[model samples]
Target: MISAVVFDMAGTTIDDRGAVYRALRSAVEDAGAPVADADLQRWMGTDKEEAITALLELGGVQPTPSIVSATFRAFRATLDDLYRADPPVPMAGVEAALADLRARGVRVALTTGFDEPVVGSLLASLGWTVGRGPAHTVDAVVTTSDVRAGRPAPYMIHHAMELLGVEDVHQVLAAGDTVVDVRAARNAGVVAVGVCTGALSRAELEAEPHDHVLDGVADVPALLAGREARVGVA
Candidate 1:
């Protein structure tokens, strides 16, 4: 039986693209570098440092610490502005699913590629502060900072499971909207469920090694309930 669910914040639980892209474009522009749309989407689910560095490399520019920092700061500021102006909304059915899971005694943990402050701000602006029902109230929040590395490494999911006192990765279901998310879950030996709300195409996600692909977060509750009932009935 799965006792907990680990969610990828941006694309999985929320649309997750607005603030980050807004921030990235502004940051790149501010740093006097041209930001390409494809590059940004390609780097989703990656940490700020890695994504910016990759972006620079793709543009045939050397990734300098100073330039990266400047772009990151600009991106952060823009994201903050976007959140304040109009926060990203939760994907349809996300709230009900989260509530149903919790009511069933399932622990929830939000895992993200974002840093601490930005995640906090976004959640706050969206009225999703910890314990704010129907959307928030996760048992824990795990950011890239909480792990040794981000997605495709399994460190983040491993760290979250440890923090949540879960011993078996199989008891955790990791859900996200990117291939990296699926890779991370697989690396940690957990069940990986992919959603198409983010950049990756449904075909792309299906081609990957994910255990399951969900149309949206709305299907999670039914998925879990069905699995649980199947186990019990058997």
Candidate 2:
């Protein structure tokens, strides 16, 4: 039985409209490393700062601390401006899905590659921040900045489990719209679910070995309703 469900933010719960990719590409290029969009997309679910550092190295820029810091600042500014100009768009039925899980007495959390401030702004705009309202709420929110590492590293997922008081990875379900999302869940020994709603496609997500793949977030609760326990709580 699943005790908690962790979800990716952009693309998984919110309709990012590719803002993350666009902002990162622009910021990296402005910082003197003309990163390819495809390369940026490949590292979509990791920390943007780490992703920028990798891009800088890939683009032959030596990735000094000053350079990485400068690029990340630019990325933050660009993303902030985009959000202010147009508050993020939520995915089709994330609220309903969250409600369904909550109704089933399952804990819900959000894990993201975004930094804290960005997540706050996005959540505030949607009125889902802490103490906002009860209609759409999550038990916890974890970000790359909050963890030692991001997706493909399992730290964020592990941290989410910690916050939700869930000790067993087998009792968790991790869902996101990227390959790293699946990899992170697998690394944490939980069920990896890929959704074809944000960044990756059904075929692209299928390239990974996920426990389940769905059209979107709304299909998650049903998927976990019939799963058996693979391990006991740690």
Candidate 3:
């Protein structure tokens, strides 16, 4: 049985209409560095600061602390404006899936590359609460700001486990929409699921190391239910 399901926020659960990628590209370009789509895709699920640094380097700019910080701030400001102008909506069936999981005694957590301020704004827009209480939509939220490092490292996933009191990695399922998300789950020794509703497509996600590549977050509850059935038969 899976004790917890850790999901990525932007693409997996929330449909931001690719605002994050656009903001990142705009930020890097405004810093006199050109960002390639492929390069931007590689950093989708990682920490924003780290993504800015890597994008800067890839764009042939020296990723100095000042430059990275400036670019990150620009990205944040752009994203905030974009989100405020057009608030993001939850992905189709995501809320129902979350409710279904929680109703089944499965803890649900949301992990993201966003910092606290951005996350707070996003959640407020969606009117979702983060806590272990029955009224909360999620058991916990682990952001890049909460961990030493972001995706492709297991720290965020491990932190979520800690927050949810999930001791065994094998009892966890971590799902996201980027390669780093799959890598992070693998690094954490948990089930890695890739959803094609965010940054990557089915073919792209299927090329990575993952246990399952689903169409969207809404499909997660059914996947877990199948696993439970198999376990019962065994």
Candidate 4:
């Protein structure tokens, strides 16, 4: 049985209408660093600061500390403005899925590439609470700001496990919509699931190493039930 499940925020659970990608592209361009669609997509589900530096380097820019910092700040400001104009909404069936998982005694945690301030604003916009309470939607949240490194490094996932009191990696499942997310789960030695609710298509996500590639976050509950049933039969 899976004791805890960690989910990615933006494309997986929240439908932000691709605002993050737009903000990232705009920031890199404003910093005079050319960013191709493919390059930017590859950096999706990663820390904003690391993504900026990587994009700058890929574009032949030096990616000095000052430039990276400036670009990151620009990205944050643009995202804040965009979200203010049009607040993010929960992805179809995601809130119900979260509630169902929690009701089943499965601990649900959210891990994201966003920092604390950004996560706070996003959650506030959705009116979702964290921690243990009747009003809470999730058990814990792990963000880039909480870890030294972001996706493709398992720090955030491991941190979520720690926070949720899930000790065995085999008892955990991590799901997201990006290659880095899958990589991070694999690096953490947990079940890696890819969902096609984000920029990447099912085929694109399937091309990466993953345990399962589902159509959306809503399918997660059924998947977990199937796994548990199989275990019971065994």
Candidate 5:
């Protein structure tokens, strides 16, 4: 039986692609550098500083604290705009599924490529107070700052599992909307469930070692139940 469920926030639990893109573009543009949507997409799930460094290198410009700070400020502004205009909407069944999991005694955790401050801010805007809403309500949350590297590194997932006191990888289910997420789960030896709600495609996700793929987050419970039944059958 699965003891805990770990989730990726950006594209998995909440839809923030537009905000992310807008913020990233504003930052890049503030540096007087041109940015394209394709390039922005490539930077997803990556560390912001790293992305800035890469962007600087590509532009043949040296990275400076001012540049990085500008980018961050712009990104934050975009995020704030998005929240004020349209606070994130929890994926269908996510609220229900989380409640069900709790009812079933399954512990829940969250792992994201985002930094803690950003994650905290985003969750708060969505009414995810620690003792209240579905945002800060998880048992554990591992962010980029808490781990050695971002997704595809497995450090975040490992940290979350550790926080949750889960020793067996098979007892945990990892879900996300990107290939990096699935790859992270696989690297950590957990069940990786991919969703299409993010920028990645089903074909791209399947190219990795994910254990399961769903149309969206709504199918997680059913997938878990099916996996349990299969385990019993075996």
Candidate 6:
């Protein structure tokens, strides 16, 4: 049985209106190293710094510290501005799904490739604070700053598992709307659920190996038996 759930933020839970990508694309272009549209899409769900560096490498340029810093600073400023103008909304059915999961005694942890400041802003917008106590909406919030590496590396998922006191990976179910999300879950030896409510499409998500691919977060609870009448059923 899955006792804990790990979900990715942004596309996974909250809807940021593609602000992250816009920031990255703008920053890269401003840096005089525009990323190809396909490249940018491929790098989704990764640490911004990592993605920038990868883009640089793909462009046959070395990821100098100066270039990385400048690009990252630009990206952050752009994202902050976009978010300030309009705070993100939660993906359809996210809140209800989260509530249902919690009602089933399942602990929820939200993980993201974003660093502390970015994640903090999102949480604040949603009236969620960082803490492990029951008073918190989510059990925990794990960011890239909390790990040595981000998605596709499994460190983010592992960091969440560690903080949530989950020793066995199999007891966890992870969901996201990116390739790296599913890869990270599988890497951690847990259930990989692909949710196409945000970034990717069903066809793109199906290209990767996943345990279950659902339309949105709303269907998650039913799939997990959160909505089932366990007491009366045989």
Where does model 3 exceed 4 Å of error?
Answer: none
lDDT of 4: 0.94
Higher-scoring candidate on TM-score, 2 or 4: 4
The residue ranges of model 6 lying beyond 4 angstroms of the native Cα positions read 132-134, 226-234
What digit string (tens of lDDT, one per residue) describes model 6 on residues 1-234?
778899999888888899988988888877777588789888889998999888877766678999989889999999999999878988888888887888778888999889998888789898876565556678888888988888898888888888888889888999999999999999989999999976689999999999999887777888778424563474
lDDT of 2 by residue, 1-234 (tens): 888999999889998688888898888888778787678777888998889999988777889999999999998888888877777877898888888888777888899988888888889888885421255499899998898888899899999899889999988999999888889999989989999997677998999998999999888866765454233332
Q: What is the lDDT of residue 161 in candidate 4?
A: 93
List the lowest-lDDT window of 10 residues for candidate 3.
196-205
Of the pair 1 and 5, which is ahead by TM-score? 1
Per-prediction TM-score to the true structure, in the order listed:
0.91, 0.92, 0.98, 0.98, 0.88, 0.93
> Candidate 2, 87: how far from true, in Å?
1.6
Model 4 TM-score, 2 decimals: 0.98
- What are the RMSDs of all candidates, in order? 2.3, 3.4, 0.8, 0.8, 2.6, 2.3
User: Model 4, 96: alpha-carbon shift in Å?
Assistant: 0.5
Error of 2 at 37 (Å): 3.3
Regions more than 4 Å wrong, model 1: 29-38, 131-136
Task: TM-score for candidate 3, please give it.
Answer: 0.98
Error of 3 at 169 (Å): 0.6
lDDT by residue for model 3 over 1-234, one digit each (tens)? 898999999999999999999999999999988888899999998999999999999988999999999999999999999998889999999999999999988999999999999999899999999887679999999998899999899999999999999999999999999999999999999999999898678999999978999999899999999999999999
**Model 4, span 51-123: residue lDDT tens:** 9999999988999999999989999999999999989999999999999999998998999999999999999
Q: Which residue pairs clash within candidate 2? A: none
Residue pairs in collision within model 5:
none
